[model samples]
Target: MQGEEQWFSRTPGVEARQKIELDMVNSLLTSVAFASDPSRQLALEIIAEQFEQPATIRTHPTPRAQLIEIVRTYARNPDGLRVLVDVVASFDPQSFGTVRLRQLFDEWQAAPSFTDDDWSAFRSALGDVVLPQLTELFHLATRNRRHRPPAHCKTAWHYFVHLTDLNAGADSVPPYMIFLERVAPLLPSSTGQELRMRNHRLASELGLITAVNEIHLHERESLPPQHHTAYLVIQLESDGIDPERYTLSHWYQWDADGWHPERGEDRTVSILEIENEVERLVFDMETNWVEAVETVTLEFILPWELINAPVDWWRKESHSSRPTPLTMDYPVVVRSLERLRTHRWHRAWHVRWQRLNTDPTSVLPYWSKPAGKNYHTLLETDLKSDLRYACLVLSEPPLPDSSGRTEIETALRAGLPVIIWHRRDCGSPDFREAVQQMLAGETLAQLPILARKLRGEALRLDLADRESHIGRHLTMLWDDPERQPEVSRSYGTPEEGIR
Candidate 1:
């Protein structure tokens, strides 16, 4: 081994490097009697090097066992394993070797002690080398499986999703849609078909069919360039979206694992009730608007903050500014929405109402008393108005709806959209069903139950919503005759609504 290293000192290339490394590894492995020994660091390095080389040329079981043993023994040292993973990932491959490496890499990733530094290093190494190689490998692997070459090997949209997770928080909207719109004309027919298929699958899984058809992949690119065949798209957003706030990560984690829904019937019923109320309110408002010659827009409001605010503003004001920027200032948001909706011809508005559970007496007194009577009066007047839309953005632990069946029935009659932003914990049946389907994948079923146990826990933690509220609302708008004309007017025009 020493002689080989000395010979390599005079020359260095792929072959020489391999010879020297292999000899060194052999010598190290011979020195380690027990695989569990903490002193076997040199053995670990050798095993990692052997693993990275092409499987065809590399030594087999002996080296593999050493590698596995190192991980099994020093799994707690995230930094050490991370370094090994990086070295392994850096190796050039002849086939789908990265997939095998990733499987092992994920094992180390699952360690409880894996720190942020470890994750950062893993991501850096993946992006720098592994991703580019994987892209090329996937093209080769999937080439025959696909009838024709994809307009582009890179599925821009799917790649966008991965990029979003890697860069911004994990749950932000993948830039796939945005990229598709920009590059659609540049894609090939085969690529378009594949993109459509994937979108259809995602839409079906997420129950988002009503929002919009998945973007046609070929709409932009006629012949995608070969050099751009890289499969992974890396995106990092500073202010685009928050994973925790958006409830995306929770749903993804649930889908990746396996978990059943808890509150199916109750969730469905609550949604139905909320929808009914919105419809009734809209109908009454529509009648009033038609009769009075006015236009109206409905605004849903959650009032947990105001209801909990201290009577002495000085004491409460300081603490108020400390909450998350994403935390909705219910009243401010409602007013802003109302202003946005204000226009000529017809104007009807409603607030999807919410109340806090602070001392009811204190909160109720202010809402009911003469000094603060305007708040109550305004709320009552708006509730009675002829509205074009009525929506309730309900939280998980919903407060009792005092409006009863009359409100729901009225909203149903009015033909308005009722939007509920329920927490995953409320155990909505739809959520459970979606989760079950996600877990039904053959691979997920093979995981240990304990590993999969946290599946639905994301929803339980109010991390994700099974139903897409924005999509549903858009669907409602698209279906409405009154809104259809407005949509058509805006369709190809520059005045498109916010995406």
Candidate 2:
């Protein structure tokens, strides 16, 4: 296995190649499914074409000898060898295990040879936030790995700078890039929002060295991966539960250009048919608008009485197949119909929204004390005082007349934009843990996606337990003040829906 060293030592230009690079190339060549000598020659030919210089492969009696001849040729031009090394670094992980290939590629590409300008741009973006406890953030992000930061690094920035000069053995990406990805979720939304664009530019400039060779370097941040999105806004109004008004008040679509409104229709339905009516509106959107948009998010604007409705679980029927939950396909979030009707709480909403945007970590779900004697009074005071408490996670179902209902209304009045709760008895620790798992290092906007994932997981369990799982019961009221339906009709009569 170590025989390559002897050949490499005698060969000029090969001295610069790392042992891991040689090993990787050898492994990639040997692992490829080659039936015969002609196939091997063809593979070598294909690899050779990637280089600028034209070369001919020598005819060898044995395939092993042929591999050595190919490398010998590559050794003559170190730049060509770099190209070969890159190909080897990014060989198909299907033939090799992903973990092993990733590790091998990282170890092989550990030369963090970026220029001063690149470091300057990265450092500037990171300057706003205090060097986020580098060792701790690293340990939290890379807990599975056995590696530790060198003892000499005084700060996270120092460690990242140090990484650029030294080749740490397990380095797929620059330590700074990884640091950015990890910290992106933790940083206040205002911080590092521009880093993605900067990073994309840098990644483009890096070209093949960073993008092609390092496949997993750019993890999908919340920015830049913009999709053509459509918002289906459903406003529901009920009068004594007899006849409910359902209106497709707004169909807002956003693309690279910006947002444009589409006309919607209104309908009247009995209390029993409200869910069915909502489903039909969604079906119409899927049929009429889904083909036009890249992604769709369903927004159900409901009064306080119906706020706890599981809109995500509602399904639309198709003649061809069984119905699937709306959440299974699109992100569904509940919005406050009452909140949209008035500008009274607009100032509070703006204050909290700004706080949420400025420091998301500070505005994480604030749990209300559900059982104290003066819990409601205390909770109201806390919410009113702290504009930073943008999200509220209740301990019980917010059904009409319940304490949970009052808590929710208070939170809404206090201008909290997000409220999550189990739709039923939520005192169980499992619900809290489930919320924790969904929110761990995730942006607030990602809750619907994460909650859908939990629901999907629940579907895999036994039917009896599935209903009991936190996934089925979790309901979130995520009202973004920035993105709202332009209510044409005032919250006047039940007969006249909010158009």
User: Candidate 1: which stretches are off by over 4 Å?
Assistant: 1-61, 70-83, 87-164, 167-172, 176-187, 207-499
Q: What's the lDDT of the predicted structure labeled candidate 2?
A: 0.62
For candidate 1, what is the total of clashing residue pairs?
A: 33
lDDT agreement with native, every candidate: 0.28, 0.62
Question: Which 10 consecutive positions of candidate 2 have the poorest summed lDDT?
Answer: 139-148
Mind giving the per-residue lDDT tens digits that candidate 2 earns over 57-153?
6767765656666666665564555555444434443444333333333333332343345445555655445563665545333321212353334
Residue 120 CA displacement from its true place in model 2, Å:
60
Mind giving the per-residue lDDT tens digits that candidate 1 earns over 1-499?
A: 4543432222223333334234333432433222344534443455445433412222235654454334333333435444544443344222234333333343333322223443333233232231333333222222211212222123332233232222111222223332323332334556444444444454456554333243343233232223211010001111124221210000000111122111101111232233333334334333432422111222222122111111111111233554221111111111111112223212222121111112212111001111242543444354345332343222232223422222222332333233222232323555444334433444321212211233223223432551342211110110111221111111233222112
In candidate 2, stretches whose alpha carbon ends up further than 4 angstroms from where it belongs are 1-226, 239-250, 255-259, 318-321, 488-490, 493-499
CA error at residue 19 for candidate 1, angstroms: 26
On lDDT, the leading prediction is: 2
- Top TM-score hit: 2
